[model samples]
Target: MSASRPATTTAPARPAGPGGPGGRPGGGPPGMAAMAGPPQKALNFGPSAKRLLAQLRPERAAVALVFVLAVVSVGLNVVGPRLLGHGTDLIFQGVIGRQLPADVTKDQAVENLRADGQDTFADLVAGMNVVPGQGIDFGALQTVLLGVLALYVGASLFMWVQAYLLNTVVQRTVFRLRSDVEDKIHRLPLKYFDANARGDVLSRVTNDIDNVSQSLQQTMSQLLNSLLTVIGVLAMMVWISPLLALIALVTIPLSMLVTAVIAKRSQKQFVAQWAHTGALNGQIEEAYTGHALVKVFGRQREVEQSFGAKNDELYQASFGAQFVSGLIMPAMFFLGNLNYVAIAVVGGLRVASGSMSLGEVQAFVQYTRQFTQPLTQLASMANLLQSGVASAERVFELLDEPEQVPDAATPQTLDDQPRGRVEFEHVSFSYDPEQPLIEDLSLVAEPGRTVAIVGPTGAGKTTLVNLIMRFYELRGGRITIDGRDIAELSRDELRSSIGMVLQDTWLFGGTIRENLAYGDPTASEEQIRAAAEATYVDRFVHSLPDGYDTVIDEEGDNISAGEKQLLTIARAFLADPAILILDEATSSVDTRTEVLVQHAMAALRSDRTSFVIAHRLSTIRDADLILVMRDGAIVEQGTHTELLERRGAYFDLYNSQFAAPDVEEE
Candidate 1:
């Protein structure tokens, strides 16, 4: 599929070299098309916009209040220019009247003024002090100026109220929005997290919400004022002179056309930019996370070239969107100024012919400038709001994801107790349904028995344990804990009874004591120490400066892998689940540490049912029962001694690990 085609400002993809973008055979990155507009698209505000308004439903009252205030403020502001024009006209009348002959009768002056199309008597009073050379109304002009001052003060106050109310309302809305996103994250299933990148998800929660917050704060006030300004300015312009108003209105449609085309195109670029940015982050994350493997295989140069490709794509997309969107302001300004020049010329002609007063001409010119000011602002912010909407759509998309099914209406609970016995009956499952991985699989672990699962890679050893833990639901059968069906129990109740220590040990950022207590937070200090001692975690803790209080960094990277494994084992021991599964729990440790862990495992599993998925055959030699698996099903089952005597798949696997590669004669 062609990636993001730009709407208005299209840029061709960079020339492709070997292995094209991101070391893949494509003209550009897979999802990123060159920045171009779609051949066609309807100008509809989609569901994302509707959803945003719905989120703001609670603040409707405040928004309505802001609208009313905007009208009043704009009405007051609009009248000030006309009042200024009135004062200018009065001054012009006064100056012309002063130049009149002192000996001339007022009636003769009026007759001569009529010939010149001037208001003969409005700028003067026919009193004794109204001398031809002098009578000025300084005190009266000051009084009139105060009214304009009052209008401006009132408008400023009204705008202040609107800003205050709107800011509070916007923040409250974004707060709820952020809270909803956090809540949605928890409700999402493990499968969601597994499939989506953490960085992208975090971008929605952080970057997207910030965009919405900032845009809402700025756009709400700007939008309200712009709408009010445009309406009031249009009305005043038409009242002054409809012909001039019509001339000024020509810029409106032209400005809109430019804004719409550029907006549509920039919107596409914004979406493409974010997508390529995510791809770039993914590439960087993967390469950096696997830095050791890259160095081991000597693919650092290849990795750098691939990153360069992604970085270049990101740069092109970002530059295209920003450059195009940036044009809105200057484009609108040029158009607005062009309108100003046209109106000024036409108004000047009317004033010269005395069809319009000089004051009125100035007022019309001011109103024309006022009209375009709002259009320019609206045109500029349109792109910002569009970008915010794009971000919001991503967030809403996550919120709309299908969640895991709720537990049964009346869930069964273990009542703080459960037998270690587990049974899987005719269970069929697959990660991808079309590619069946497990078919009609069944296994039973009797109470206090240690069941060992041995298989080659892709043999579904981990899949079986996942089924038992109910991490993935069964497709065609029932898995039971003791005698009760696992589906009947709340997932929490069912999962709490089982403890897992996987090959990958996860330790959050906290102290060693805190991480160990994570499996069972209620564990007392004494109990915590016992579990740590049991798993030999205490010995390492004591060696550190802070003992059990030693802090672990992310994923416990501050500690050695062996120590992390030991901490996980201690945590599971502290949990003390009715059933335990140690899936390659001892794999990270050295031989000496392995002995310590194996000894702890034997003691911990003495009374509970346990399943051990192992690659090292020597460790599971004494398991009560051994299940040899191949191709997602059990191929053989017996005790270690019985399996060895049978000389089957288990025999070959056991010997393979201990067997040295044969030295062939040269």
Candidate 2:
């Protein structure tokens, strides 16, 4: 069999270069590295994180409500400890006051003790605020305890409400992000997909976006609450004692230093971890897609080795990221403990000196814990934020990809009566600007004619059809259908009028009837069956247990290749298009099935202009016109007999195929 060049935009492959990482043959799969796209090394945490937050703008009202709730909750929680400390002071005062003589005032008792050189005991009694005549004020203690209980309950309620609102905001923002990514994928030019790996793109759309969502869900509410707690607790500490507040402030710089150092190191590892994750996913997709080919070529060992290397790279990156980011919590905890000790010693001294009440000191101690706990939480969340931002950068990169050129501002429409007359005028194109593929290529396919394109490999036959379809913008000149420039017509309008079937069959996971209807969504059952019978798809479909209802798996491996080809042909026939393209459409079918499909194609070609790209010389013998291409140029053109008589490029190609098989070449 003779084959033409593949319709790929990549540069030609380099000869057996150094094996990639693990001594893989031909670099795993042809152009695997290119498919993986570019590696992301640098991370912009600040900008990406800000942009991620900006996704919540649409839910701004909800976010504001969450903020308010967090503040209220943290305020109530802060007030609770102060009130409980007051209750503690009350009980101590009651017990001490009861022991005093009923006739002696508290001041007199403290003065007498001081005169006796028991000043420490005197100061302790003064700090407790005991009245010599008072005893056990159970009523006041119960009221203070009730107030504390109410504050705690209110705080819990507000916290729960805040969390609920934050969850909604996060989910909504992620929903919009996913929708945006999905829309961006559709708008991106085909060149992007051709240049990048399917798995990597999928990772950004699936894994990366999912990571962003999870990160926001896990961190947003707690982060908000923690920050508010820090502020609220700090205020309470200052209210209790300025000196103790100053002592706690001493640890702020240390906490910042620890977070900055550890987070800086972990950020890079987080970036690497996600990058390697995308690379590994790309490899997995490629391997799974071509599992049969790998076995056939006996390159499984190379593939496995390549996989192992990528997997190990991901593992190391993930471990480094987790291990390094893990340091922030412990370091912050240590600083917090040191701050706690300082506050405790200073508050104790003040209490002993009778300069501060025991209740005030106890409350200040509680405030110190509250303050340090929030700082600890914020430090711990740094790692989560870093990973989330790394994933956000990737998703943003995709969303920022350049989109396909917009359709014509004023689109042209075809007449109700269709005539398929395709003309390529002074057309030029190339996969790479430096390496020209097709230049000054011109052709005319009259209505109701079968124009066969025959060429050796790399001769640009398929590229010609791609140009007609406007899959790639031409470097120069124009293509027209029925005297109207195809560029003027919207892509949708142009494509709706044309039908294409490639050698590689694509059938989505659906019943046979559903797949057939894909070519014409509005096509009736009768029309589908008619096309199927015409292309002989009905013959095999009926043999199945469910007939037309038989469901095809995702890979469509349940059916034979030839049967799949027949289904595609039937689909094209059902389209009833004005123009048709068959890029080696019959290559996969057996000889007998090929004959049946050819007859069906001949019937479909009536009154339609069809471009058939084929490798078999015998197939084009009956074509209305045959064009021979060589190195992206049309070298010969005419009827089969006329070309043979001319004894030109077509003659050489014909003899090469019919003559003693000179080691068949593509």
Candidate 3:
């Protein structure tokens, strides 16, 4: 009876909607949009990226500290080249000075050369800070070297600290994000799951979240370092020689142009890539979940073809995103090289003319390299940053899904002693507003009575049960228990008093005793065994090697269907609910097991309000009330003999099965 049925006719299908993947009914691709192929751009890159960044808001202080550390580290690193250049000047000046005559002062030698028509050489000598006959000063050189080492050490220490803090902030932020997503999932309505693929939702929860974590971890600190390094290096370059600094600056625009062009093209591809990943995951999940069905129907090839199509789409999207973003690094490298050559030629000429010292030129070259290197690094990281943001957008989309209606702010409670007298008055409902499933239906089940519902497949049998369970809201009218409107009571409190055994038995991977305890967590071993015995579960369970301790497999395939059904009934008994729902509970068991199950059912149903949905008429022959349903309406209601005497819908349905067999025997 819980078997998958189309939406009730009361809720008719809506007209084709405007949004969702493939314009699916209800909404698009569950909580996400569908992707057919690579798009030209992301749907909302700016807002999604902003939202992703917002995840760091709670860690703003830690992030700020990391930024400060990065700045200090870059500043210390920037001074290293200048200090080294000073040492080089000291060594060069000493070497040049040592070769000159010891008797002549430094200025006297330069003036003598100017007097001898060698002013060019004199000017070069004048620019040098050398003693007339001095050799290399090991003491000064040692001091400079030590200072450079200290700067590097300090920079390294700060960078290490920055990295530690950043990792902490990132992990904590992602941890909270993961927790929020998990909670939000539970809050989503059942219809959302029914409309969306499980694999797709799983990809968003698991894969996309992981990608966001990795992206932030890999890209955040490095991007900050590169940017700060660029700024610090540029300042040093300008201080040393503005002319050469200007040459390096030319590459900035080139780098920007390359990044903007390639990143713009690649962002869309990255979005497509992630979208395809979700789609592929969905197909794989569906394929594996129904592998046996596919094999039995001989449709393996079709499933394979579908998988191949989705896989190919993912590959294409990945290739396009990677190929486009990949161009950024190379282009930046080429432009950087060109800038390097220009600065080298110009600096060398300035040094020869004595307008700039040899050491100054050396420092400028170092600065040029530092400036270009970070630009290249930034270009290379564009792909990672884009990819991470793309994944974040997908996750954000899931978190943004509309949640189910909220519980009442002040919920009413059932009486301590529940009577289980359920009444449905003028109830109208539908899955879609355009269609009607149940309209103005009224029924009253007095306390402790068994009401049997018999109908064809689409007669809204399960729908009625779902209403009592409040799985969906009513369009009009209300359902009440003990005169208290169900809508006023909290869902948890309302369902706590009811027990249900569905046609499709569900058993988790656990010991038999543990599964039984699931019905009532506080149930003791003695109570558990009592329920098991009552449901006839104690019979087969003892035959197993471990008895109650025997573990059920993940799929619960270790036990027969009948055994599983009995376990569920035992679980229901353990719950000791005031009301019970059995949806074709005995349909799976053999006739002999059915007889045993009937005894258990009778015991379980004692002094409890019971709703039995059955296809086999004989199973409910002794039901207190037999309701014949047709097209979402109750056509007849009476005891077994009274319905037969009426010779109406119930009589015709009954004779259709039993009368045919009698006629054949005759």
Candidate 4:
């Protein structure tokens, strides 16, 4: 994986205040308004989501089975209580009371049983005839007990099955999502990365996706189970006593109202929490990357103070969001208890007055509890639901962001063996629409020719090379390769044809050979060794105890800066791209290493269309053409000797470097 390079721009004299378009100062509120506008809502899963889900569609049968099992599990748990109540009522009136005759009118028998206080098992069975060994037709009691046990067992088994299936679905979904997100990150334009922070992007890939995964894994199932329980309980309650059921439902609307308000407030806070987290992550990454500078300047106290303030801001936002969201469950529980008390009181009186059986009252109380439990759970999971939605919004925002440079609708493929002839015609570009960074830039590097770009910092030198690589689009004019507009060529085709060695060298944690072979995975051991030798990286690799298999940590911290740059050049050599772009590839090397790198670069440029951004004027003096740029346009263009003879901007720049030694001598 290629690490993105930072855009080259002139450093502002003073840091912009909070809310500036560039970025906010430490720990300040995020400038949401300064960032890109809110993205359009296209689909539930966004484009990336759709692509990911499609991959999992082949397992739809498993997903469907899981959903069906869940529904059945919920149904059984809900209806089991009603079935028990029916059996209890039958035992009390038809068997235990003895008011029921061997043959009698059913309605009469039931009415007589009620009059005789046979509504409860204890009262009805007290005076009943009992067999010596059987104890009052114990057969009926055994049957009822067996039925109740069966209901419980069935419900338990179903619940277990549902849980197993749900977990399988969630794990699979997350796997697919992560894979697709990583792929898209690879496909996106480099310019897209320039406008965003690495920490923010990383947060989206790791933290945000985990939030969604947790929601799906736990919250979704809980919500579904709760909803089914509530519905089943309400049905049974109505059957037992409609009046009691209505009374139990009185608190629902109030609970809902409270939930709506809390959720709305929490949404805003959750967004703020995510924003603060990104800022904090950015701060940590920056400090770690520049740790040497901090230590050298003895600025540990300043760094700590800055970090503490950012951490504090994150703490306040997260605390407020979680605390408020957490309150909903307890609030719902209290209200549910209040509802339970009212129903119990009312149902007890109905049973005592002989209007309802004791069995009916018990069932009504149980149903009331069942209804309240799900309601409580639903309230508790509300926070998870909101967090998932917020994460979804951020994930979708990245997927929705317009590509910096649109790909051609009918892209052409490069020839199997490309003869690189790169040309730019009056090209212009700007990262921000209002500020043009390059204007009317025209240049060409014929096949097997080296073109050197030299200018002051922020003079659009790098931007010119970026256009040739199609990292960004030309705001005006066109770029052509082999007589075809580069836009008409597929991005993959264009980039794969060019090899780049940037000033900043980044190496992932891996073996030395793995880093060298990154650009061409199929390279043989011999090819890898040859490329390494050519770039002088083989010298360091052989010195390590493990040779090519030596392990390196992130950013190749185990190696010196010169070695890292050499490794990157080694990677480019292995790729053997038709066109090469070297952006200060030798900038960090000492004079000794620079000589080695220059030798490798000269070898690389042979028979290749090459563009070099050189800060050391001495290295590029023999180039066929030298382009001098300033403030987004070409200020001077000629060979080094021709430019010196012309005595213009290039002459002055060249003279300044030589004048420094003379001044020291004086």
Candidate 5:
């Protein structure tokens, strides 16, 4: 179910420059503490007024047509009432008030005219022997009635057309907006995803966009139609009787004030409701993704309790928002009823005193009702509009986020035959500057050699590889590929020269061949099989019911962990990069699978500079060089035998893993 939340804060005022708060150029607020708040105001949505104006894009053309049609429709409606009143006045003067011509009494003139017409008709119909004076003309009455019908028909047709056009525009515009929002989510930087929970992001893209779409599709056209109708009705009311028009308008300002107050409160509630929905979605996603772990740990009750809290929060928020927004309709209706009663009472007294005609009073009442009808609709739809605005603000917030590190303007391609030499000069890095993960350090890996990085968790082993691939930029220092600074090389070109296989294997939802082809999209079927065979994944894949055509489920859950690792190896094999980084690539496999993977690695390492982050020292025992790292710095580097002889961190790590367990004596 859809839910809403109160807005916690006003949207931020636009900054004069890209720099926010302090004077630092392009920097966010002064410190990390400032980041904790309601999501930053959408930098690109502009002021609230501007955002409202932007919403008009959907109905601009429709609005113009509505204006023209309303003017014409109102003119026609007014003309009919005025003509009917004139006809009534003429009848009263000629028949009831002795205001006819003085040539004869009213009855005598009517009799004489009827007799003359009957004789003339008898002369013309002599040959046919037709009867005379059988039917009355009543042409004036018929003409007025037909004219009124025509006017009503024209007004209704225009109204229908206007409604259709407005609604069509609203739906189309909203569809495009939703599509654009989804596209932007995919284009956002990886760091954004890291900072925000996946569930929250998904909620924004789906729930928030859906809310905006629904509001537009359901309420926007009604709003436009009502607004035009109200304007037209008010104009007719003034034309009918200025005094009654003034009485009807007296309640309008009061109604608007009441609506404004309610809208402000409802807008806040809607914002809160939306936020709670996001929180609830986040909780649900966490529960499902970790279902296996939660069940294994017997944390079902705890999970349920957490879910219940979030569910209750959402319920409260949604109910409150709806309840508050719902108030506008009744409030407006109350005022509209008051205005109607006032107009009816005053118009009745005027007509009774002969100050206004019966027809005029009738038309006046119709106009007053028309005026109230649109106002009522506007009050109701204002709630939807405010909710839509809140959703738009969230969506724009994502689109407006700064893309800080764009690819280079002019990128240099890597050499086709790269020497596989990598060097880091004075490199320092951090996820947050206050807590540096890696300090100023330098390292080198030569051509066609294996380099094993051994470090405790969080010692920056993975960070080093990430930097080499330019996934994250260094705060200080430069990294070079084949003697060329990596920053100058095209990002695509730099990455294409490197291959990585991590501990966690990610196979997308596709056939085995498709997953392998991801590494080299143009690779032939034979080449793909060769890569799979090299990694020993082909044996298991071929055993599957569909062989290579078998589809992998999300996270590769359909296959064993060992098989997923093998598939990843197959991908890397197909990539055939000049440089390879293996982060515990064989850690998940069994002894047999590890031996097979080791063989695959041996084949892949030829003429490639390989960096292996090893947990099991036995896997990298044959490396050409081993770098024992501690606290993000290399402590020792040499062949495995040389490091063992030195008896340093490497020797200690190797002994811990390969050391025989003590036997118990009975």
Candidate 6:
């Protein structure tokens, strides 16, 4: 099962181990970490967008609520400028209300009538009673100002509600996506992990998921409101005066053309920027994880130089991409200001001629601002949306990966008190089909027999154990326990029957007692203590100030390597399996601890089948049967003495280790 991440307010790089956020610890240019998503050009944007919509389908209700609130907000937003114009008209009307038409000249009436375009000369004269000394209508101004205030307040309230609902929708969608990623991690095969970096996998789970959350929070509301504001404001502008609406809208295409050209050119740079960012991140991770190796090899300068080169590439790409994206705002702003100037000139003529009222002309100018603002904002965030879509594509790719071969619908189990006789009949296996690692191999270990597999590197030592545990299925023949094929049994049943201790020790952060009882969670303290004593874990643990209660940190760094190995051995002992697989299980321990481990292993192997894989011949000398593998084939098989007498590959391998020390006598 994939481990559930602990809930935290801060979004870090990963789980278990993370060098630092962005790329490398204190490495890379400032603000480079903010660009963590995969490059946009590398992704299938059309499909990813469709899939993103599909991901949000379940939250349609919440989306609809947000959409409704956005519409209300934008509708109210469209009303603000119109009310301001109405207030202006109210002031104009107040001054005119006190005027008498007799005071105005005949030429003024004719000009007003011509500009009105629809009003008769008498109608225009009746409408405006211009007086030489008519004070402003204070009461009417207050009412219009109050109405404008109310409309703006209502719009702000709707905007808040829309933001709240948008947050809820984004959070839920991200939660479900994260849960899917977690579940997918477990279903993925070991081959998948082998092919990809653990850090990258974790980035998708932590950083990319967070990116999606933030993208929605930042982009969704802005996208929705901007689009709605554009539509509503355009409609209101056209309603007030088509001529001004046409002039204001003329900038849309020109602004779009400039934005589109710059965006197209920048998309590749954005992709390159993120790609190099990921590359720099990988380099940082490798250098950091192997920090000890680098120091021991005195390659600090080399590592720093390599990191610097990658960082410089990332810096260039990031700077170029951001610089291009930055162009949209100023470009849009310039065009918008030009459009605003054009509208003001045209609207003034119509207002003076009485072809349009003072209020309507004022409203038209505000609508022009509303119209271009959304376009400008959207243009600026195009890269962010692209980055998010790219991330979605990466996440979806993992979700859609081919899973491991599943278990049989009707799986079998080992019989009660079954003997542990094993057989590998004509089994052929390979990590890659083009390269055969193991072929036509056949062997058997009778009940209570200890089968030691001896081999050099790349000779399939670990691969053999993996096949038996059913971690990897056989490409050709099958193995059997007693008379039943192992494949017929569920992996859980097959694995549960076997106890394994690998060369690498894995102990979670916990007390000594907890690590000991890992293989058998229900084990009582006495059982845990007994397993620890058998594996000599109790011996050193007792020396610690906290005894069995001593807390070990991650990777068991607080404890000696030998101590960590002992805990794992103890864990296997507590499992009490019918079969055991020890892959150089005592390699890390010193000779003194090796003796203790051997004694415990000897007891545990009694009356049970055990597979011991080791390069050290001295350790497996007492085995009842020995299988010497060469290039994935068993070249020699017999008791240890027989193989030595044969004087073949096994003889050469054994003698190399057992050869007399070449150090000159001192």
The top-ranked prediction according to lDDT is 2
- Clashing pairs for predicted structure model 2, backbone only: 35-197
Q: Candidate 1 — which residues are off by over 4 angstroms? A: 1-45, 101-107, 113-136
Name model 2 segments beyond 4 Å from true.
Answer: 1-33, 37-40, 662-666
> Rank by lDDT, descending?
2, 3, 1, 6, 4, 5
lDDT of each: 0.77, 0.83, 0.83, 0.73, 0.71, 0.76
Ranking by TM-score: 2, 3, 6, 1, 4, 5
lDDT of 2 at 546: 98
Clashes of each: 8, 1, 11, 0, 14, 2
For 1-666, candidate 6 gives per-residue lDDT tens digits of 001211111111211110111112332222323334444454566778788878888999989988988888888878888878877876776565445354556456446556767355334434444433355677877887898788889999989988888888888899899999998987776556555555566656776677667777788889988999999998898888888888988998998899888887777775666566556666777788679889999999999998898888879888987898788889999999999999999987776665888678778877888899899989877878766775676678789988878778998889776678888877876555555556666777788879898866645567677778876667788799877899888878887888888876788999988887789999999999888888888889888999999999867889998889888888988988888888888888999889878878898899679999888888998888887766666767777888889898889899889897578877
Q: How well is each residue in 252-291 modelled by candidate 5, as lDDT tens digits?
A: 8988998888877766667777777877787788789879
- Candidate 5 off by > 4 Å: 1-49, 52-172, 175-183, 660-666
* Candidate 3 lDDT over residue span 248-335, tens digit each: 8988887898899899999888999988898788888878867878999999999989999989888989999999999998898899
TM-scores of the candidates are 0.87, 0.93, 0.90, 0.85, 0.82, 0.87
Off by over 4 Å in 6: 1-42, 97-140, 415-419, 482-484, 661-666
Error of 6 at 232 (Å): 0.6
C-alpha RMSD between model 5 and the true structure: 11.2
Best by TM-score: 2
Which is the better candidate, 2 or 6, if ranked by lDDT? Answer: 2
